[model samples]
Target: MRDTNFLIENNAKAIWHPMAHPADMRARPPKVMMRGSGVHVSDIEGRTLLDAVAGLWNVNLGYSCDPIKRAISEQMDALPYYSGFRGTSTGPSIQLAYELAEWFEPEGMVRSFFTSGGSDSVETALRLARQYWKIKGQSDRTKFLALKRGYHGTHFGAASVNGNANFRRNYEPLLPGVFHIPAPWTYRNPFNETDPAKLAELCAAALADEIEFQGGDTIAAFIMEPVLGAGGVIVPHESFMKLVREICDKHGILMISDEVVTGFGRTGAWSGARLWGVKPDMMTIAKAITSGYFPLGATLIGEKMAEVFEADKSGLASIGHGYTYSGHPVGCAAGIAALAETRRLRLNENAAARGSELRQALLALQSRHPIVGDVRGQGLMAALELVEDQTTKKPLDKAKMADVAAATYEADVMIRVSGNNIILSPPLIVSAADVEKIAVALDVGLLSAV
Candidate 1:
């Protein structure tokens, strides 16, 4: 094995990180994680830190999930590689599809179109949505509507619907006819509305207005995260998603719940749609499907979508898009094991209890620290928005966030610092003690930033 110093030296030099500047890497070298156990990871320097980001919001079962590892190894030995593109199929993939159908049955998702990861799942969902409209002979229904702070994925199709400018600006000339509506974020919204129910109604009215302006027949789908993830863990009002569903139904537009981050129990329910008591037309899911043991995702279809795709004799109904690894047997095998463990352990229940505790702790931290301007979350996914002034709600600069993040690491907990928000999504397997540790670490970090 190479020495720690050697690996650390080549970390930033060897690879270009997806969402980071090349120059910034030189200013602050990245940490090289050598190992993970339970909820803690060890850096190359042998410093073990509690992981609150859950390996980019995957790793639901934690690092030492023996069942998933065993499942992957067992499947690899049986069938190392096979394609699920049309004529070919794998056993694990078939079983997984059936399992997913059962798992998301409550959400009305009856079918699963597998993908390689979250981005692929999102891309697949968008394409399927447009295709759904085409099959219905409403070819003009090609536009998409999304929330302003939503993060769909990186593909041109996905990026087109993504509301965040940071994800869209550099990749201009993206798919046209995609529009955005204001997110029902009480902390910061154009309406300045603080009440959740009223905010939800206003956001829903905005969606209806956009559909009216664009002509409802011209809009294919309204895509949104049940709980906005990458843009910051902004948990919408309980009524927001339900209201969106009602509007989409009235407009005859499909609802695509981008559950890439909120899927598989991160949001205290089996899925975020269930959390809000809404059943979407399609759901783009990944992340916890295989619990980070493998790269796997799927665009889950509702019964209505199934009927359209199945009943169609038209060539337009044929799915032209598919990844080479649409349903890799090993990935599906890991998913089966992960899902089983997820259910057996009832991670959703744990997430609910832990999430409530964590949120209260964050509220306490907010009371003590003036820097914490806003605290938002649902279930295990949470974020603290740092600000220069609580009254003005002026966001704290990146330098200060970085300092706080560094301090959190010094306190032996790793957190994700995005823009001015400090995001925390610890593994679902975390216990009460673990939650306390995370809260204490954040308290220390907040102190440094203050």
Candidate 2:
């Protein structure tokens, strides 16, 4: 066995974790995950915990996925790496692209552009949106509109279009020409609208107003998440996406769905766009693409967009953007295996059933715990927003939320605490018993906070 103390000390000394302060790691120390199986993970200290966050909202199939592991091993041994750039590509990459095209055909996606991860996928979509407009002889259309509190990823282009200030404040002077409208979050909004349907209409009107104000001809695309993920699992009204789609179509603006978190059956559907019966011009996907076994993402192009690019006679459609590992053979192999298993197990159906049960349990928790102000999510992706006062809806302080997270960890449930929200996105394969355990552990943590 590895020396836990030595490993922790070395990690604190040498590593700077993402979304965390370096100094804080030395003081509090980070959990060193040693192994994982099913939906549970073992730390270096030999403690096992339910991974409710599913390794940062990925890992839909959970750990010990034999098919994915075997695919990766076989691919690495046969042909580990190959450049998909230019005219050169590998067999696995080509196969995966064909499979994805077929899989996303129901959502009107006919072409797939591979990437390294979610951020890359978002960046590619943003660039492609602008390029698509330029190719259509509307070069002035460069602005992007997105819903407030939506996350697109950390890349410069994606960060510019991100709706959350927390992700944007530090990185100022982001790409220019990006605007945001209020999200269709009924729990909190500028309209003071309690009714979800009304709020969605108001939000859609606001989007239309923004497009008109910016001049529809000047806007290239409007990007958003079907269900906002990193910004606290904010599930909008059922009609929200459809309305946005209509508005975008009317204005000739491309609609880009940032499905990084909602793709691959996380939202009880093959894709979030499919969940709402809305087709986007472009869709960014990652995380669950390879079941977190290998880093792989793709920006899917809609049939219309693909046709435009295909019909372009100019050399502009030749494309100048691509990554070295855009379609790593090993990653594609893993993705192929993961997709097959996802279909065989029918994980989307399981996610829908488990998600309903989980959401109901979370609502029950809100009724019992004064700290839980709101419970919101779709499918397995969910969040519990804590508040100091139920009447006024005052959010819980960061320190208190940290305490709650610590308590949850001690209770053997690994959840993610972002601000006052405790996010839970267990693997899609999570059983009903697993959901119960998560709820029980969260109850212990909430009670401790009280």
Candidate 3:
């Protein structure tokens, strides 16, 4: 509603960004997007660009998904809000819950504990894991395990299990007894091992070693993303998750798959767990659950936890955590419609087809661009890690990365530059031409940076 100059002048004055410095943002304001259509967005400057970030990796069906918009509108008119707390429930929430349970059944998820967003979903899952242990009479199993470079969320429990120090340093004194194992990243690892299968084994062994050292019985769960999203899209080997699953099973530890980004056909599969044929004990689903039409998330409970809680005579099985916006009617309606559209379109197959092309193009770019240190991704998610020196692999300067991203935007593609990594996660509806446009934009970015 406000003019561009009016909005830009007061952008950082009233609001602080999620992951940026206030002073720095005031110095250089972020882009203000005014409109979106299909997989493209238009900024206040009247420049339209391909949204390679996919609205923070949530807009899978893109801005033009009419079914979701209609559902939200209809739900707003019918029932704007309703609490899914103790006694009352909404129609949309109940239907969405059943849909989700059926959808994630392959991963063994049987029930849904709704939340407001990804962070809430993760926080709920963590709390649910701890409660499950307590209900099982293992109160001492309060610790958690996560893979290094794996990001959970911003909540205290999620941050404690987050492997990125940048997100953890300022929020110290986090939940205690949280340990991290080395991820199966081939490019950068303590092992310096390049072979995928071998690196997977090494990572699995590290998990086993951690369990032995920490006393597995004391650990409540091992939480990780099937394909790491925020931490440079570090996709582990095909066998890596299965290895972790086996380790968790052996230790009686719950496997909570953080699928906020990889869910809803983003990972070329129904879910990341299904991608590797490993069924986790729990899953945090959000982001694309409503296809960015509304904020909605859920901590999907597996059959194991469901059975324990449902059949429990103990009061410890009772859930003690909830959010005000949990199971919001409009959000649930959006999710139900989004899931329908996602399945009807068979977006998973499209992601597989398009992601293969995108991967090859990025690899080619890496071959041409000396600054490109590495390329890693699965399905629609991918990243280009930049370096100052090809031989030494020194990370590209942040200033240079900013310049590259700016250049890419100028060239009509909007990409996410996190740390030295240029992350690209276009909408699942992205076409072959869109992938080429992204590739071309990145080429321009690399040239500008160099």
Candidate 4:
């Protein structure tokens, strides 16, 4: 029995993958990923896959980077784990926090808090918002509002604040007092209006109306993604986000920007909040923090909010929340190294250049394929929306779209499919030649699907 077969059999017999049924997986064993280098990953069968989605939109530095690997190794040898409690912190942890804060201050960000991952980071933001109001004597201010079709994380608090109904279907009893508003998907145009400024005003007014209807005094925060990620890679007009900021300010609701997918060169900028100029009270980041070299996430709480946490009304009872691995030494080390490498290589500038070329290439695909209804986004983060009829703007049947994605998986490239929207978040290190290869394979896959 070969090692590959042995590994597959053991995986089938023992492991349970996320979002998969065990019975079905037994028949069709999972792909055995063995190694990765640059922008490509290889399976045990010696097949290489172009990771267009950046290994769940985190592998910004791609795989097998010597610097990040070396940092992690050195940290593990020195000290691998630590708790964020007891008023004690490690060097890597403190340095990483300082670096993150510096990156945000120039963009008007004030302070930040750390967390284990995106879900917890978002939860941290929500909790801070509630606490801020509580300390200010607004006990009734507890409700939250989010945008529809957004993907924030999978935790209970995150799901309660998230707008996607599919994610909340199974769990009936969720954290109450969270509301959802229309997303900024201009393609679908739920408001049934164009004219950028008018659209922005309408959307902003709707949010204000919702806040007023709920009683602005009762709402603590409004959470959203500047440019939605899993919610079909939808990009909003510049004025729309600005309008949202104004609305949040009017209602005194803290705006928490969930940039888990759009941070770190995904949108040709360090943070989507910076590019759009919609500064949030708190920012939840993950995915590219360590370039997928390790599992780490952080929640950046701005100065205004940090002040509330710093007052320490309760000597020992101040912000009684923490994770065993909140700032794991190894993860912090990787983060420090990753940020340095990003600056050294100017990856954000690279994203700006490649993203323009990639978007053009994707739009060109629409010219060749009628199914391609829309090609939109910035930097390496982009999406191609499929439609049954371009005139009607009807989405391809959900089941049909899944079939299309499964078929596309057989090709050389690995792309992420969200309903009729095919997402593309290729590694920042991808070159022009790599982009062309991906385009050719994706073109064939789209044609075959149609």
Q: Candidate 1 — which pairs collide? A: none
In angstroms, give how far residue 177 of model 4 lies from its true place. Answer: 0.4
For model 1, the superposed segments whose C-alpha errors exceed 4 Å read none
What TM-score should be assigned to candidate 3?
A: 0.99
On residues 1-450, what C-alpha lDDT tens digit does candidate 2 reach at each position?
557677876867778888888899888878899999999999988999999999989999999899999999999999999886657989898899999989998888888999999999999998999899888999999999998899998999999989999899999999999999999888889999989999999999999999999999999999999999888899988999999999998988999998899988999998899999998989999999998999999999998999989999997787889998999999999999999999999999999999999999999999999989999989999999999998898999988898888888898999999888999999999999999999999988898778
Candidate 4 clash figure, as a count:
4
Q: Write the per-residue lDDT of candidate 4 for residues 1-450, one digit (tens) a residue.
A: 468768866867788876566997887777788889999998878888888888888998889779999999999999888777877899899999889989777455666566778888888888878888878778899999998888888889999887888778788679999998887777776888756567767778889889989999999999988788888887877787778888888878888889888887788888888888777888899888899888888888887777766775754226767778888889999999998888888888888888888888898899998988988887888999999999998998876676666656667788888778999998888888878877887787787766
Candidate 2: stretches off by over 4 Å? 1-3
User: If scored against the real structure, what TM-score would every candidate get?
Assistant: 0.99, 0.98, 0.99, 0.95
Score each candidate by Cα lDDT: 0.92, 0.92, 0.93, 0.83
| Candidate 3 lDDT, 1-450, residue by residue in tens | 787789878878899999999999999988999999999999988999999999999999999999999999999999999886768999999999999989988888889999999999999988888889889899999999998999999999899999999899998999999999999899999999999999999999999999999999899999999999999999989999999999999989999999999998988998999999999999999999988889899999998889999999968777878999999999999999999999999999999999999999999999999999999989999999999997888999999999999999999999999999999999999999999999999999899987
In model 4, which residue pairs have backbone atoms overlapping below 3 Å? 111-301, 111-302, 111-303, 112-301
Q: How many Å off is the CA of 303 in candidate 1?
A: 1.1
